[model samples]
Target: MARIKDVAAQAGVSVATVSRVLNDNPSVTEETRNRVHDAMAALNYRPNAVARSLRTEATRTLGLIIGDILNPFFSELARAVEDEAREAGYTVIMGNADERPDQQDHYVRTLMEQRVDGLLICPTAEVTPLVEEVSLGERPLVFLDRTLSGVEVPSVRADGSTAIAELVAHLRGLGHRRIAFVSGPSTLSTGRERTEAFLRAAAEHGLEVPEEYVRVGDFRAGSGRRITAELLDLAEPPQAIFLGDNLMTLGALDEVRERGLDIPGDVALASFDDVPWFNHINPRITAISQPTAELGRRAVRLILDALHGRPTDSVVLPATLVVRESCGETGPGKEDGS
Candidate 1:
């Protein structure tokens, strides 16, 4: 097999310059890059990835830990991250934590062992000791969607406060006074933030939310279905229901269908993390539309920036309300620009 020395000799350049070309380092002039490429092609030389990674102390790989793989939002976000990472010349290793803190820790340890260049995590409710340790370490870390307070890591997530408020106002305009929210685990930042936003929005409109009206779920479809069933069973059921995420929205829809209740008739429905399928489904769901793909792109950029010794800052994208028939889009709430 042709070696680096042979390519270097053939290209009439030093081995170090050949190595720079192999690494695609821009410092190598265009003429030198072309010469190195031609030499490699003529000699049929293929650089050793393992040796390069060992020498450089960089794997050109990123670890991504998502909350749940089954959730459409997470799945889509993973796809976007992968696409952007590939374009940036890095491979991505994804871990499905399934919203379990223990599982998340397992991936963290495993990825660190693999020596990934950086990590992008959508954290669970509880931060494990391992997680805390890694955050304090020198590795570049970026939070995806969910964040932990005082962690000091940069994050890429959406601000849904305005969208949640608009949703509540839309419900109120449709005459939905007794509304309910099916939320995710309280341990995660998203669950807590969404709940707080909902409460604040409700209070602003003089709507009283009983303690029972707030139900916490596992951010999965099953939890959504279970919570929806329970909510519908109340003696005085909520006139409208707002689910925290798309997977929960699916479960809520399943429960609604099983009970033969019509959306916007028996119980109006709205959800956060609008997925593509939401628009295709019958009656169409009302949702808080986030820049899901952009969130993924930004997460990769932030982590890469950190890896490159560049300054990094947290990015918060905006979430907007998309009015649809599921929430009975009455004209009163239209003024909020939903």
Candidate 2:
């Protein structure tokens, strides 16, 4: 109900003086600033953020578009991003794509229309032309967790090669030769890289993975369940199964339970992303844990650097393997050893 004019009239100062005080301009005397503050408090006046942003041409807000909010990995990443942004005096708007390219594009366009100072995205499998358009435009953009090929945007992602190799080696030590892989869709970089890494590692251990052993899923629980079922139906089923992500791992676990299969006894299990629930689950899951919070912090820093016209570079953090009961490692062993 109160406006700047009301504050100015109450403070007995010019509207320009009120504006300078609100903007924290040092030219205004302390006495005048206190008067303006008192008037504002008395009238319960709130400044219009839209008007301020329009004048400065900076919204002081960032947009984040995640592939799937349902995935615990993305949800944790979002929380970290929000925390880092808030600490840096910026606000964040998040969009959940639910692993759909169309929905991802819609959020991107919507955030752009809202004049977000920068954007961070964990892109979906299908690449939308709008992503390229945004990257080429004036707005600073960064990719998180996942990225698109041929796009030059700066990004922060985990390098899972070493961890995947470690996992395969661990399985080999456990005497699992016929390893099956439930891979995510190959449309995104993480999917392709992870699958490629797993196969390469399996070969290094002198193990052969049949083409039938590799099942591709859409990074959802349903796909995980279906793929696991298919793998179980094979005449010569795999001795162990590696899931691409946490959501799919849940599905695989469900199918294994439905068939009354005992983990590490009937079929060994492992997953890529390590979430909080992984530890409390019946068979503590073995996982390659990415530096998720660090990734979020680094992503914000990259976008802020670009926003301030500073040099920026892409970052690739390494993942570490956490051995647990699910991978048949229950004894006292080194956390980082195979």
The model with the greatest lDDT is: 2
Q: Write candidate 1's Cα lDDT for 113-204 as tens digits.
A: 78898889999878665565466455678999989875668889999999999888888877899999998878879999999999999999
**What TM-score quantifies how close candidate 2 is to the native fold?**
0.82
Model 2 regions lying over 4 Å from their true place: 1-56, 335-338
The C-alpha local distance difference test score for the whole of candidate 1 amounts to 0.86
What TM-score goes with each of the models? 0.80, 0.82
Candidate of highest TM-score: 2
Give the C-alpha miss distance for residue 137 in model 1, angstroms.
1.9
lDDT (Cα, tens digit) per residue for candidate 2, span 1-338:
78777889999997667766766778999999999999999999886443233223689899999988888888889999999999999999999998888998888878877878988999887655567546655567899998888778899999999999999998998888999999998888999999999999998999999999998998899999999999999999999999999999999999999999999899999999998888887788898899999999999999999989999999999999898988776545644333
Q: What is the lDDT of residue 167 in candidate 1?
A: 84
